[model samples]
Structures are given as C-alpha cells and as structure tokens.
Target: MVDFFTPDQIAMLSASTVRCDFLVKFEFASSTMRAWNGNTELVVAGDTYLPMFGFGQIDGLGMSGGTVSENVTLSLSGLPGQALDLLSVALDDTPEVDQQMLTIFLQLFTDEWQPAGTPIPIFRGFMQPPSVSRSAMQGTEGATQSISLTAENIFYSRSRPAYGRNTDRDQQARSPGDKFFGFVASLISKTITYPDY
Candidate 1:
C-alpha cells in the first residue's frame, strides 16, 4: 500500500521559514484595448502600504470541483485626492470607462537569512474594475475617511496569469489560446452582439 504522506510533503509541512513581507503592484487600464506592453508598477509618493488586503479562495467554493475564481480586497488609508482621481479614470461609471481593468501583482517573501532574497509571486491576475467606497466617520477625536477597493479575478488559473489583449500571434502560439483575453472578449462580444443581430 502507498503511504499517505510522502517525504517531500512532510518536509514542506515542517519547513520553519515563514512568510514575513509582501509587495503589491497595480496596473490600471489604458485608453486602447490593444495590449499592455509598458511597465505595471504603481508610483506612489513617499511610503504607503495597503492598510488591509486579502486575496484568493472565494469562500465556500474553496473546495468545489468546478473552475475556481479568486478575489482581492484592498483598503487604502489616508488616500490622497490625486490618487483617487487617477483611480477614478480607470474605474468610472460610463460603459467605455468601466471596461477598464486592473492588473494586481502580489509577492510574498519568506523569513530567510538573506534580507533581500527574491520573493515568490503568490497571486497575480487581471481584476475586474474595483468597487470603490469612501466612508467618513465622526468621532470625539476627529473624522476619518477611508477608501476600499474590492475586485474579483477575471481568470481562474493560478499558473497562468491573464493580462493584455489577445493578439493573432498569441492565439496561434498557445494551444488553448490566451485564457484571460479570450474569455473576456468572447463574453463581452457576445453580450454586445446578441442584441444587434
């Protein structure tokens, strides 16, 4: 009979190293739907970290068999008006503007000997436009307004990340075609074309 746990599995479970830090980057959609060939790093002034963040596993569906989708929730504290303006451009009310998407990259690093060791990407995917909300509470001390961004992963695959437009070259290169762009384009086109024809 085969053993329940393998040597590699035991070693991995008993590993002492723990993840200590994380790095997150966001890429907002641009004017054109062609493809993203530019840098995706978000530029912020001074030091700023997402106060609250969570990604992966959609509740009860965690153990389900079908295609699994993930979600990301980010809370930004003391967000400046300038940053909000930039985000507004990406996530707006108009149909054309709302089509814009966000690419989020999250990297996790283990508590190893090296201070600058390479980080492993834990989650990376194109997220639907965030549902943003601003809340202000008045207290005895003062009032605070915080902004929260919640988005769902557009594609389900963990190994393959979905970003950029689907090109003819990309379609021909991969057997299954680009998962992210392919699925989205088909869904959107179907919605738009169904009523027209």
Candidate 2:
C-alpha cells in the first residue's frame, strides 16, 4: 500500500488540469485571478469546524467541548504566464501536454453536460521519465524503452455547512451588506495606494 502524504519519496506526480462544477472554494471564497504570482507566504484559507457539546447533571447546564474542523492552507506564488511551465519543470511533468487550468469557470468547458447536472470531475496528468526494462529490451535489441505516464486525483472539496440558530444569516439580515462596505466606503474609498509588485 502507498502512503499518499509522503510527497518526498521517489515518484513525482503532476496536476496538469482540473475540471469542476460550482466554484473551487478558497479561504476568501473568491475565484482565482490569472495574472497573480509571487513567493507568497502560506495563509489560512478556511476552516470547517464542528462544535462539541456535552450535557451535565443539571438540565440547563451544557458544557462546551473542543471544536473539530479541517483547516486548509494556501500558498500563492509565481507569475501566471510561467506557472504552467514552472510547475511542469518542478513536478517532472510534460509542459507541452499540460494546458494548466487556472480558473473555475474554465473547468466547465471540459465537460459533457447532461439534462440535470454533470459529474464533478478533477484530474492530474503527468509524463513520467522512462525506466530501463532489462527483460523487455533483450527481446527488442534495437528499440529503446518508453517513458511511463500516469495521472490521478490528489485533492477534493467538501460540502459547506448548513445554517443554524447561530448562523451569519441574522447578522446579514440586520445589516444587509451595510456594515463593512459602508465603513470602508466612507473612510478610505478615495485612497489610491499602489500595490507592491
């Protein structure tokens, strides 16, 4: 059996393209921009936590336990133009064959839709370097060995949580996009500070 978490070992996998439905959910809950790249530091993307609660001897006394949630980390880097080429070189993949799907919208183009909905498709394609086969080479003395190729899925997204009593809906209902947007618009809307390259 193979241990998936040990990425340092011998084989190098590739992720040439990804196709999917809905949006590829990130921490900011936004789509990826094409022309962004750099050696950016890792940041907490998002979290999905399940709160634990236990009942005490008294009916009203409920003790709150620890929270369990999956945390995601995102490290954005590299210029858009060089991303595919760089990733291919670093991952030992075929740059010529990999199209490098960058946006969630682009993924929808790859599918064959049905009447209701389509399958949630994700992909990882790679061109592996050739390994010399001693037994096979003996039979065909003149021909050279061919490189091994492989592709597989590595990551997947999970469903978001349902709304409850303590949900953000109450806050939104009260303000209706008024709080932060109004505050920022009044304070710093006129500022045109340039971004650091």
Candidate 3:
C-alpha cells in the first residue's frame, strides 16, 4: 500500500524510455547469492548481481482486495545439472530460519546503460522452504530443473507471539540481570479494593 519510490525513481517511471531489471538477493547459511534477471551482470550499490535467466518470474506481489499476499512465489529454472544450486539452499533451511530475501527494482537508462537512480526494493521478506521440480523435454537431450521459493512477508510475524512472559523469572532468563517484569507476576493474583467514600 505504501509507495517506496524515490524522486528520481518516480521521474524515471514516466520517462519516454523506461527499462527495468530485477535484482534478487538470496541470503543462505554459507553464502549470499545476488542474481539479476538481466542480459549481463550488473553492479548496484557496489554489489554485483550475476546475470541469471532462470529468475523466471515473481508472483503474489500485486494487490488483491486492497491487501498484498502474505507470501510471494519466486520461480527459477536452469539446467538439470546445475539447478542453480538453489536446491541445496532450500534443503538447508531446516535447522535455521532462512535469512532475508530481497528483490529490488533497478531502473536502467537506455542511453548509456547506466542506472537512473538508486534502486528500489520491491520485495523484502524471509524465504520459506523451496520446492524443486524437474521435467524433460519431448525432443531435447537434457532436462530442466526449477525451484519455487515462497517468501513470507515480514509483517506476517506480527500476528505471531514473541514467546515472552510477563514474569520476573522469564525476564531474568532473557536479560539475566534485568527485573523489569519482576512485579508483574505477583500483581496477577492480588486485587486492591477501593475504600467506600
């Protein structure tokens, strides 16, 4: 619902010639992979995004019924042999909560292939588990592999509990020395009645 475009990015939108690229950052356990659905590698904010045609498409980002979806689906594909190595990352998500998955909209100027302005982050969320699939072509000698990653919006966490208890013991477990909630538990069963005037 909120517009995240800068002045320059806004101006670039209504220009005569507008070109845009999508940059996807996948933060994994061992390494962070930066990829762009572009013809060539691009460097934005000093970070290089590898050219990857496998960033097939992104869905669930559009508004529906005045609200955005909680999860966005990212489709990626490559040779069956490589599979973009995303399958491993997907499988690694079991023991840990996957890190932030960022997707930015990079506006490119057609004249010299330079950026119009600072890129705008279109999708910011943590990636859930991914689903991988493989299929063979009718006449091709090799097969293609694809993975669908569901990126759960960060706002979805607001509906979940933080697991914090309003007790001195619980507070001490977290801070070890802080007793901010020390009196909260004792006050639960004690009721102070007001005297009649």
Best by TM-score: 3
lDDT by residue (18-95, candidate 3, tens digit) is: 877667777765677777666667777788777665546788775332112377888877733342455666666643
Candidate 2, clashing residue pairs?
27-45, 37-78, 38-78
Kindly list the per-residue Cα lDDT of model 1 for residues 58-171, writing each as its tens digit. 221122222346656554444433322434544564443332454332223334422132232344445444454444556654444444444455454444444222543455
User: Regarding TM-score, does 2 or 3 come out ahead?
Assistant: 3
- The lDDT, on a scale of 0 to 1, for candidate 2 is 0.25
Between prediction 1 and prediction 3, the one with superior lDDT is 3
Query: What lDDT tens digits, residue by residue, belong to model 2 across residues 1-197?
Result: 43322342112122244332222211111222221121221121231111111100111111122122222221223223342222333235334323233221111213232111221222222222212222244564644322222221122232345532223353366556644333332342254446746
Weakest lDDT window of 10 consecutive positions for candidate 1: 33-42
The segments of candidate 2 whose C-alpha lies over 4 angstroms from its true place after superposition are: 1-94, 97-136, 139-141, 154-197
Native-structure RMSD, model 3:
12.8
Candidate 3 ranges beyond 4 A from true positions:
1-4, 64-69, 79-85, 92-100, 160-197
Q: Deviation in angstroms for 45 in model 1?
A: 20
Comparing 2 with 3 on lDDT, the higher-scoring candidate is 3
